[model samples]
Target chain A: AQSVAQPEDQVNVAEGNPLTVKCTYSVSGNPYLFWYVQYPNRGLQFLLKYITGDNLVKGSYGFEAEFNKSQTSFHLKKPSALVSDSALYFCAVRDIRYTGGFKTIFGAGTRLFVKA
Target chain B: GAGVSQSPSNKVTEKGKDVELRCDPISGHTALYWYRQSLGQGLEFLIYFQGNSAPDKSGLPSDRFSAERTGGSVSTLTIQRTQQEDSAVYLCASSLPGSYGYTFGSGTRLTVV
Candidate 1:
């Protein structure tokens, strides 16, 4: 089974400072990772995805994630934070080797609070 | 549609009653997915519909939960004898073939009282 884990339930960062939201995963085969953001009263928005290439994946809103094969982690990062960046973040994983079908599993989510 | 759209942005239903949530995936999107967002369970995948193939019901919690996509465009998720635990936001998303990023709707907030 493919699963994702967001270790931090919440992360607080000051405006203009760097922010990092951690994510780890476990999959039977190669993992196709992705990040998503959800604002209050809205559905999730796609941030970025790591399909096959590039350990460092850049996403919407100046967000980027580094995929560490050894660590089985894809941590989302931003060079500078804005108060508007506050939202819930989710990490999802899809096992590319799964012959059965394509199913993406999501993490519990981490709440991001960017204080200005 | 320019984006995925879900109907009944907010829904309040009596416990034990049946409720149906609808989703209109993005036009030309070949893959549609249903997910439930709740405080306890977080975001859980309910079902996945790709083209004309059989829908994946593995994520559906129980028999009380059922969903159908008509003409490969509009989808409706039906929950019979709803429980309080079923109260949460139901989100719908769609993706093009071989596309990793999915566009999501605003979601329908279902409240069972």
Candidate 2:
């Protein structure tokens, strides 16, 4: 089974400070990790993904994530936070073994609040 | 369409009624997916359609839920005898073959009263 875990239910950060939303995963084979953001009443927007690439993957809205195979983690990061960065962040994973036929499992989600 | 499109931005229905949610995936995309999201919860996979292959219906929660895709383009999800528990945002997504990411629709908010 492929699963993702976002440890924090909510994260608060001051504007201009770096922010990190933690995510960990479990998979039987190589994992395809992804990050998505959802605003109120809107669908989730893809941020970035870690396929088979460099350890760091940059995404939309100045966001990026580091894929650590040893730690089984793909934590979303931003060098500086803005008030508008507040939203719900989801971590998802898809296993390469094709056990469930392209079903991507998502984490419970983490709410980020960037205080001005 | 440039992105995945879903119909009936919002729907309110009485309990026991059947509701249909529609989705139009982007042109040329071969993989389509349906997912349900409850308030403040993660997405629950509903079904997946890839090209002409038989869909993977393992994620459908119950017999009351069903879906179909026509010409491998437009898709509809039907929920019969709707209950309050069925109320949630139904999201549709699609991707090109072998694409790692999905383009999602705004989603249909179904409220069963």
Candidate 3:
């Protein structure tokens, strides 16, 4: 089974400072990883995905994630954070060959608090 | 183009009652999915519908949770004998076949009392 792990329950960063949210995955073949953000009472919004390409993938709202194959990690990053960026973030992973037919397996989620 | 839409933005029902949540996917989308979100938690995949194939219900938490898609368009999720644990935001998403990104609806908040 493909699974994702977000070791951090929450991450705090001051406004204008860089932020990093850690994520790791376990899967059988190649992995398709994704990042999503959720605001209070709102559905998840896609941030970015890694489906075999450059290690660093850029996404919406000035967000980016680095895919490290050696460590099986995909960490979300931002050069500078804003108070509005405070929300819940999730890391998901899907096996390319599992074919058990599922969308993706999401992590427990990490609460991001960007203080102003 | 309009994104995915769900009805009954908020639902409050008593225990042992039945509830139905509706989802209208983006026009022309062939893949639809249902997910559950608890307060301050990540999404839990409930079910997925792809074209005319049988839906993947492996993620459903219990037999009381069931979903169906009509004409491969609108979908409905029915929860029977709802429990307090079932109270959460039910989200719906749609995507094209083989698409990477899924457009999500605002979600229906179901509260079981």
* Candidate with best lDDT: 2
For model 1, how does the per-residue alpha-carbon lDDT over A1-116 read when each residue is reduced to its tens digit?
A: 78899999999999999999999999877788999999876789999999888899999999999999999999999999999999999999875643334567889999999998
Clashing pairs in model 1?
none
Residue B74 in candidate 1, Cα distance off native in Å: 0.5
Query: How do these models rank on DockQ, best leading?
Result: 1, 2, 3
lDDT of 3 by residue, B1-113 (tens): 38999999999999999999999999999889899988767789899998888898888999999999999899999999999999999999998777877888999999999
Estimate the lDDT of model 1.
Answer: 0.90
Candidate 3 local Cα displacement, residue A69, angstroms: 0.4
> Compared with the true structure, what per-residue lDDT tens digits does model 2 show for residues A77-102?
99999999999999999756453345
lDDT for position B96 in model 1: 84
Model 3 alpha-carbon drift over 4 Å, by segment: A97-102
Give the CA lDDT, 0 to 100, for residue B33 in model 2: 93
Question: Please, what are the lDDT tens digits per residue for candidate 3 over residues A13-109?
Answer: 9999999999999988888999999887677899999998899999999999999999999999999999999999999986454343438778999
Ranking by TM-score: 2, 1, 3
Instruction: Mark the regions of model 2 whose C-alpha exceeds 4 Å error after superposition.
Output: A97-101
How well is each residue in B9-112 modelled by candidate 1, as lDDT tens digits?
99999999999999999999878999998974558999999898888888899999999999989999999999999999999999888777788899999999
**lDDT, model 1, position B40:** 44
